[model samples]
Target chain A: MDQALDLSGNKMTDLGNGHAVIEYGSPWGRPIARWVPSWGEEKREVIERMRKHLVQRFGEDRGLRMAENSRNMIIFPNLVINDIMAITIRTFQPEAADRMTVNAWALGSRDEDPDLRKLRLFNFLEFLGPGGFATPDDQEALENCQRGYRNAREAAWNDISKGMPRVGPPKNDDEEQMRCFWREWRRRMSAAA
Target chain B: MNADAHLARAATASGQCTRAQVEEFLYEEAALLDEWRVEDWFAMFAEGATYEVPPTGDGDELDPAKSLFYIADDYVRLRERVARLLKKDAHSEYPRSRLRHIVSNVRITGFAAGIADVTCNFITYRTKRGVVDTYYGQHFYRIDCSVSPWKIKSKRSVLDMDQLYAGKLTIII
Candidate 1:
């Protein structure tokens, strides 16, 4: 399920000053229901209801566009706003050389229908939060990378060269976003020194 | 006494499930989890059951629809959760952490219309990769006693800690 949203096809635009946005365009311009065709009838029904609600509330064109597009925006240092199946605003703070605290919140539209709101919250829980299916794996991957860095004395350099030779915009899976963040981080550290 | 004896005694007396029956059920559920019998544990829930865990410090009455929860799985999502965790690719649990679930302070707070509202305090210890983390919480349950083997209609585990120790609730609490 996680791999279906192929980040390799996403388009990343550098927003300058160590910020960037990745636009993950939906396949066939369909809503989430179409993304996972194997979902059971119950799930498909809920998604359809929510999609119809969106169309009714915002009219056809805007609603369809809203359902089809997802964006991840990084704010220079330690904040990310992911407007995906649900809106997630996340930030992290480093406490020590090897420790950091992360916080996340789900954002929803005001006065949303009770049923639709439940669906939104469920979507958020499925992917964004610490207990979610996706984020915990992300945490594990990050922590494993941190552990590997214990050998930094011998492996001093980390690679972020993905898509460095791309002709135009960078893909989401590329290291361009990290490159942006590191560039700004180096600038700040150099200035402080 | 065996499970059937307890249930028979409880049923003959008041036609209602007693605290003993509830405790037995909870203990069995905990055992299934500790033994990593997730599929068996999932079977204890009703078809449309809900499993929720509100953020630490949030009130028990906080509506998951309006507020954020560590987990607020509906029937479909709950099934998906079980399926995901049982897979070899669920990296956080791929090597499956060692877990011990301790359930205490069982109480039958309310009962009506074949439904019983139950509560209990819990402390689950998870050891993984040589690190141990403790998750202590109070669980609020709504069990449907109308069935032979009471099914869980809703289970809400509310943490008492001020914050998650490592900001990760990667284990089922």
Candidate 2:
């Protein structure tokens, strides 16, 4: 527990570079089977807050993954918050869940282009000036960012559809949602390029 | 030989556990889950047994105290989760998702004393109301053979997705 807590402090601390690595394949490239942890202490407050909210929204299993990487770069396109909403929709309104999974999400308007979508995320994180997402705290910021992030996820996935491994999205119209990290991947490439 | 190989050799050397016996044990467990036999499934674990669903990655060390897990349940919490599932108001499961668990590639990785480590590949297809989602993973079991029909000391399921592809882990994996 202490080791995990300690390593939680070992963050990359460089979203300034605006680059994050997205890894989806097996660590050992095994054609079969997978195992995976808790956050260490450096971001104790942040992690705890994220954990509480996430645990309440999703069940314990899926929620723990988000808290485990609380201070780490947010995994692209798979926001834990969005998952909470999605799961709720799935439970209460299966039709809505289908629509949400189909016609749904992002941090931006559905109309935003890929480039603008990239800029929105870059700005959303720093959230420094007026009109920026200035929440009372990181916890709220984490919660509030879901809708926009979902929108951003949609836009980001759209840009790199060709580069990503093309699996069919849940709905044909929602074909923009790619299978993996490429969801937020090519933005880093294009933003850096 | 590698440590895992050593473990595998040790388990079979006692010759008390056959490959078929292990396979049968797994199938029986799967049937209980398929029937939504939550209490029976819970009963399959030893008193202090754990069910560890780690992050969706490969080969996580899976230390409960140190590593982050998706579902890290001690017996008490595990029972609570099972109880919640049985509740009529549990939305995620009230309508009840139909799940089919396919267990394949069974292997006896390690065994010592009364415990044996078995690994198997799993692909679970969950269908609820009309949406269908498929989850694939590997299960690593630390099983106690001292008991009749054996009991799970620990079950570590590692999913293949970097993110959980399913909306919720409402059902047993």
| True C-alpha contacts between chains kept, each model in order | 0.76, 0.00
Where in model 1 is the C-alpha error above 4 Å?
Answer: A1-9, A27-66, B1-15
* C-alpha lDDT of residue A22 in model 1: 79
User: Cα deviation of B90 in candidate 1 (Å)?
Assistant: 1.0
lDDT per residue for candidate 1 within A127-183, as digits (tens), equals 778788888899998888989999999999788899899997788878788899999
Model 2 misplacement above 4 A: A1-193, B1-11
Worst 10 residues of 1 chain A by lDDT: A27-36
Q: Tens digit of lDDT per residue, candidate 2, span A95-146? A: 4412322111222346544433333333232221111122112322332344
Highest TM-score against the true fold, candidate:
1
Per-prediction TM-score:
0.84, 0.48
